[model samples]
Target: MSNLNLSFACWDYDRIQALTNGTVQAKGIDLNWLNMPVEETFWRMMRHQEFDISELSLSSYLIAKDRGYPNFTAIPVFMSRFFRHSGIYINKHSGIEEAVDLKGKRVGIPEYQLTACLWIRGILHHDYGVHPSEMNWYTGGQEAPGRVEKIKLTLPPDINIQPINDEQTLNQMLESGDIDALIAPRAPSCFLNGSPHVQRLFPDYVSVEKDYYERTGIFPIMHVVAIKDEILEEHPWVATNLYQAFVEAKQKVYDGFNQTAALKVTLPWFVSEWENTRQLMGEDFWPYGLEKNRKTLEAAVTYSYNQGMIKNRLNMEDLFAQSTLEAYTL
Candidate 1:
């Protein structure tokens, strides 16, 4: 049988590098992989459907599915997972001493519906009784000006969301104390360049994240692998084939991290770090299937629904291809 030719787009993360380098390949498929920044990848996929398969923002994917707009179907392969506590930066002069202090404060965000912000907002509400409607939201680009939300949003009446002035960026606003805090996937430039005024809301973010994970078991999923629905319909087998290929690719990265002979990567404590992670997160720490990630998925769905990004709550069966939901074992 001849292999089907398909285009896939994603960032050049080490786990997915094997697929890009031809070490791991989907069975009966010839993949044209494009390594690009995540923003451009998601923008191209969401705006033009440029690729047959690509990594998409989890929040945007849920929005697309809820509205039945994009003709795409997702798999259980989560391309990105991040704990977002470290992503929140605050102005040192602001009186925001704790999560509860965010109430009535002004916060800047790159986009209101970003997955990281959604997770942070949900965490604040659940942990500190600070709801989304409690704070004023300003949205714009972090570094440059004139960024807009990728998807349309119809939020609740009480929610305060406004765009920043064209003259300023979120980072500038954060540094000037125009906004009390900022929540984003990447730290603002002011925070990155050691501006004395900008610091993480939780200075001890590592400990907070570890304790939060222990309490909730949610390592917040950020992105998911999606395929055009037409492609899935034309070749149903492509679903499981691609899923298995991604699993194999991730295993290669794991194996490299665990090699004890010499450091495979640049990190001096690579093996020790791997051992510590294994003890905390178990052997297959970064799992890619539905069952192993049910709690995480459920939390994301609830957050999206609560934040008004998705009109309805969706389940795993609704979001992922059925063929890739479970793996057979010996």
Candidate 2:
């Protein structure tokens, strides 16, 4: 039988290099890998369902499914995860020395519904009693102007969110102290360029993030791999095949980290860092399947519902393909 050809759009990550470079192949499928920046891929896929499969925002996917958009369904493969503490930037003159000071402050975000911001808000609310409704929100592009939410949202009345002027960007707003803080996946250029005005809310974010993980066991998932519903309806087996391929691709990266003869990554302390991570997070640190990630998944669902991104708290199982929920044991 001929292999099925499908278009897949995602960012280039070391974990998925095998699949993108054709070293790992999905069973009965041929991937036309479309490597692109995450923002473009997300905008095209969310607005138009442009790809057969793509990496999707976890919060956006939940919102779409809850609203019955019917364009996509996801497998349990998480394409991106990060600790968002480092993403929160604050202006020096804002008088915001801590997370609680964000209450009643003017905070900027690239979008209210971004998965990273969702996690940030949830973490602040839960860990420090700073609720989403406490602050006034400005939304626009981080570096460019006129950016808008990819998915439509009907947030509760208490959450005050507004778009910045079309001519302005969040990075500029944050740098000039027009907004007291910005929460985003990427650090603003102001912070990257070492502007005296911009700084991370948690400057020692590595230590803070480590403490957070030790306390809560959540590594905050940002993105999931989704297949168009049309493709899934036609070939249900595609879900399992793609899921297995992703697992294999990820494992290859994991194995590469152990090659001590020569460093697999460029860092001088790559092996030591890898060992420290394993000591802290265990062997299968970046796991793909559902059961291994239930706590984090459930937390994300809760955050989405509490922040009004979704109408109800979705069951964790409802977020992924049934076929990808289990694996064959040897």
Clashes of each: 0, 0
Native-referenced Cα lDDT, model 1: 0.90
Give the CA lDDT, 0 to 100, for residue 167 in model 2. Answer: 96
Per-residue lDDT of candidate 1, residues 1-330 (tens digit):
789999999988888888989999889999988889998998888888999999999998989999998889998888999999999899999998888999999999998888888899999989889999999999999899998998889998889999998888999999999999999999888988999999998999989998998898888899999999999998998999999999999999988876688888888877787888788888998988888898999898999899888879887688988888755221
Instruction: Give the alpha carbon lDDT tens digit for every residue of 44-101 in model 2.
Output: 9889999999998888889888987847999988899999999999999999999999
Per-residue error at 171 for model 2, in Å? 1.1
Cα-based TM-score, every candidate: 0.98, 0.98
Off by over 4 Å in 1: 326-330
